[model samples]
Target: MKYTARRTWPEKSKSWEYLGESESLEEFALAFATDKALEVDTEFVVIEKAGAESEIEFFKVTRTSPYGLVTAAPRVESEGSSTDNATTKDEQSSNDGGDDNYGGVEAIAGAWRGVISNILMFVKAGGAAFLFFLAAIFLAKWLFNAW
Candidate 1:
């Protein structure tokens, strides 16, 4: 799956500007659009392209802070199938009564990434501090022996 990020400034121009593309929506959202742009006058959309079909999802900026803009649930708008024989009974039956849980799984994976990164940072900091303390103790012992 490919995701593309686009933004439009209605006041400036009606045309949408392509920001970039990524393999995941979370990466695209985290890479594009600053807090100021989301707050001021920009409208953002993420285009999800899968095989022959594509989906355009509009994002609503819910919260804007120094970090970035928090988006509400995206409004999904499908562009329809590209091929005539796209729909089949088998496919329809497979999808019937089943909720798409990709978004949920992606969110969980993203949260886990944040937790793991924080843990790695803490470990690195602690290791560095311990090394510094060891070096200080060694230096103190050397100085006492010299005296």
Candidate 2:
């Protein structure tokens, strides 16, 4: 997952700055944990093809965010098609911009969502198979009790 984060002032979009993109959100979290800023918002995105026959490919992410914003864009195929180019965030930032050192992803905040999202995706992808697995476990439990 990719994270595009900008630090925000406490008063809601009162003043903001784009810190740039990280291949992982941990980079952003490090900043989040340490930064005195009371608020920050993040976006998540996924890229996929419409179908095997369809020439069109699309990137989508739910707009739903308990924080601020969420987004998705096609994986970087070419600079032309890549919506999340590394330099784009720098270009957009109002602050004098460059990569900041927050000592890797270990120092990040809001990681619980990342973990939850991973589990959610697993369950979503395994919808049918997961149900079957649960049913098998229930059957085994019943048989053991009967015996």
Candidate 3:
């Protein structure tokens, strides 16, 4: 079976960065594990094909907490036209500039979400502190009364 290694960063776009093709799965796995070119948060998939006209199999490669790479089981996809399904260098380049507006909007939204999350975290901490202060005051008052 022929294995093809491809990577894509979800935060960037859906375009796949084709690494290379190999006949050995071990070679692809080794490269996926040790390749410095691959980004840390990006995803890698190995496409397996039995023959030229067979169904394509996709295996996702993920990094474990121990910094080791692991490949998931193959997920079979239906065969389609080569030109329609394939992500060539030319196609990737052409699609890059077209999505600038979409990416900008996504970035703005992400930033706003992050800000809101930080605000909520601070509010939560402040609320907890206020409750703790009230509890301490009540405890002090009870101790004074008993004395």
lDDT of each: 0.58, 0.41, 0.57
Off by over 4 Å in 2: 1-3, 6-10, 37-147
**lDDT tens digits, residues 35-138, model 1?**
22555434577677665577666554544554344454543335563243235423653575322353466568888999999999999999999999989888
Q: Would you give me the overall lDDT of model 1? A: 0.58
TM-score of each: 0.33, 0.19, 0.32
* lDDT tens readout by residue for model 2, 24-117: 4544434333443333332222222224432221222222233222333333357664566445644744253323443234335447668889
Compare the candidates by TM-score and give the number of the best one: 1
Model 3, range 39-74, lDDT digits (tens) per residue?
Answer: 445555655555666433333335534345554543
Q: Largest lDDT belongs to which candidate?
A: 1
Candidate 1: where is the Cα deviation over 4 Å? 8-13, 40-42, 49-51, 66-147
Error of 3 at 69 (Å): 48
Clashes of 2: 3
1 against 3, candidate with superior TM-score: 1
**lDDT at residue 23 of model 2 (Cα atoms):** 50
RMSD in order of candidates: 20.0, 21.3, 17.9
Query: What's model 2's lDDT at 31?
Result: 38
